[model samples]
Target: MMKKVRVERDKQGFWTHPQLPEWDESTTFADSKKWFSEKGLDCALVIMDGDLGEQWGNGEIDSCLAWEPEINIQDAYLVGIWDTEDGVVAMFAFPQIILEDSDKAAEFKTDISGWVSSDGRFYGKDERLARYAGSTHRKCDCGNIIPKNSYCNPCAEKRTKEKFLAMPVVAWDGASYIYDENTDKYFSNPEELVEHYAVDDLDSSSAMLIVCKPNYARQIEDDFWCDDLPEDISFDECGGVEQETISLLNKLNEKLKTTVLSYSPGDQRLDQSLLF
Candidate 1:
């Protein structure tokens, strides 16, 4: 995957691409089209909140990029910056009317799928998060109206990295883990912990970054890696992860339902449940 040039927020809490011309009220649809074409980009982008993208995706608004007479370009920019999901996406559109006739460039939420995103990520929450210190709006520490008690998502990630680097020990796979004070041992991964205790201990009060499979890892992240998991569960990305997890869980569930344990508790043998 090509690395995405994540846009940074200026002091005013605004995100601007160094390569693209900034859009203002005086700008026009022709201006937006020019911005798209100048970058040799393929299309125009709209990013409004809620059902707007859904409506457009289902083909409800084919001619939604309606222009206005006074400030088509400026209002579009304001609406996008002030309120929207995927701020400043790209699109391939031409005004049906002449440049002078329309006031706005894109009157509705635009389709981001048509935009030029060389990066693998779809430009929405991820882009919005990155634009404002891993936050969604201008109110955050990066650029938000109200400051939050907890660190923004990106800041939390930085904190996690700092903790990981500061750690003095790690398991064979090189992952960081918490020490079991009672047992006087620490596990770098979940595979070691699961066998030593009951199933509930896997995700109990103890928090850790667990690697179930080579490609699958889940971090019980909160204040610290050892902090309790958040009470309210929220998904990070659901586009395809939901299906992928469902499939993987089904396989794991099938095996668990069929497999039988041969070793009793505390047996001096390999925990063969991992083999199944």
Candidate 2:
């Protein structure tokens, strides 16, 4: 009999250890490969445990998931070995010995496990192996793995949504913009935000907008709008704000038939909404 520490990949995609979070975290296939480089052990050959065993007879699997050759199931706790891109070489990390004509026997417990007499396999679930090796499943041209159908469910739905997005839409004129890292794009329209950076506010420091008209002289003498007091500005250019100087521009532009200026907010001479 051998010992086995069962691990399960959780719903959140984490392989947790029963007792040690840190230890379990290190067992990630990616991390396992990284450890070798960090410790300068990349050149070391892996001395895998367990060897090809004799066959086990019918009906004696005390260990969980013990490989049953009669059914082509694994015998024991086979540690799935992932390759450079995962699914490299599959190994049976099992070790319990079985007697009598065993093609391949997996132990629920340990000693070590054996590999087939060839290469290029990774220890993974049947579905996973089927997906990667095209053993029992096929890949969509979209690169989605599916048991059947021209497209995976997700790919089909994605295409449908893409068509929906392609439909013409009324353009919105909003000033804000967002940057998408995945696509390296800048797009407006708040409805399309996804995975945006956490920067809540963008500052355009002391920014102001001045509405201008077409065909105007570029350097025409215009009133300067400043948040702070300017030393050389004439009071007339300040919209003649003083009640005494208000007559300088005139109460109305008689030629244009529009109010030249209305200093009072309550002035109902013109429709404020229409002015906008």
Candidate 3:
């Protein structure tokens, strides 16, 4: 690992780079790339979300860095910054081209996995590296070992399907109930029974009279399946409402009302209230 590079901003919103003082907060990504190109480093930008690096000291914000593909250069460059016991620290790391010789550059590229340090040294593991590493095994956001990139296998597939085909399934992997495509069933992710229900065709905003008509609520409560739900009771059908779901909606509505109370009726009011 190398030492960390330092970055700081003055009171005037001017960001400073210890290694690359010529570049600052005002510097655009294109300008930075051009600067790196002038310095003979064929680099690309790698912007990682702060959450991914939070476990390592990086703030939960977006961090951008220039990734050099041809690392054969002599000078190591500033990578990014992270928080330390003292304060925010800038870091640096070597690219494959600079670290390895021509014969080993390819192998280095294959195994180029490392973390960022404020002292400008490469640490252990990094999510950004793992994403491009093309490794067979990956860890999901839920801490489960997955087979694909950032998310678990099923999650990745579900996300792809949802994005590509606009699937109506609401992914509830973080919730108590998780959908299982294997058996077309729902499973309890919780350790014990929590008195939850799976609602079907329950529209929250509509507030239709039929919802309170006869034994509709009772039928819904009665048909609530903890393990699995019927096919008709999906996001596409609506009308689903569990006890907690209803409570959440009520709370949300109350909060919305309170928020509306604080603001003027027209949309133009937001322009006055919110900061640009």
lDDT at 179 for candidate 1? 43
**CA lDDT of each prediction against the hidden true structure:** 0.37, 0.32, 0.36
After TM-score superposition, the amount by which residue 16's alpha carbon in candidate 1 deviates from its true location, in angstroms, is 0.7
The reply for model 3, stretches above 4 Å from the true place, is 1-7, 21-31, 34-276
lDDT at position 100, candidate 3: 17
User: Candidate 3 residues 1-276, lDDT tens each?
Assistant: 233365444432223345554555566657755555454343343332244435334443333232111232234455544333443444334332222112211222335465433223343465344233423343466666433433455666667445433333222223333332322333343221111222433332221110010111112332345436556575223466566776675566555543421111111101101111
Q: Kindly list the per-residue Cα lDDT of model 2 for residues 1-276, writing each as its tens digit.
A: 223466554332223223222434336645644543343221111221222121112222222222222212223343332222221233233222221122222111123232221123433434333233323235576865444323477676678546434544322234334333223344443444322322433222211111111222222122433434365665455644676644533443233343232211111111112211
Q: After superposition, how far is residue 48 of candidate 2 from its true place, in Å?
A: 13
Which candidate has the top score in lDDT? 1
RMSD of 1: 25.1
Worst 10 residues of 2 by lDDT: 263-272
Off by over 4 Å in 1: 1-4, 10-13, 51-276
Candidate 2, residue 245: lDDT: 43
User: Over all chains combined, what TM-score does candidate 2 have?
Assistant: 0.19
lDDT agreement of model 2 with the native = 0.32
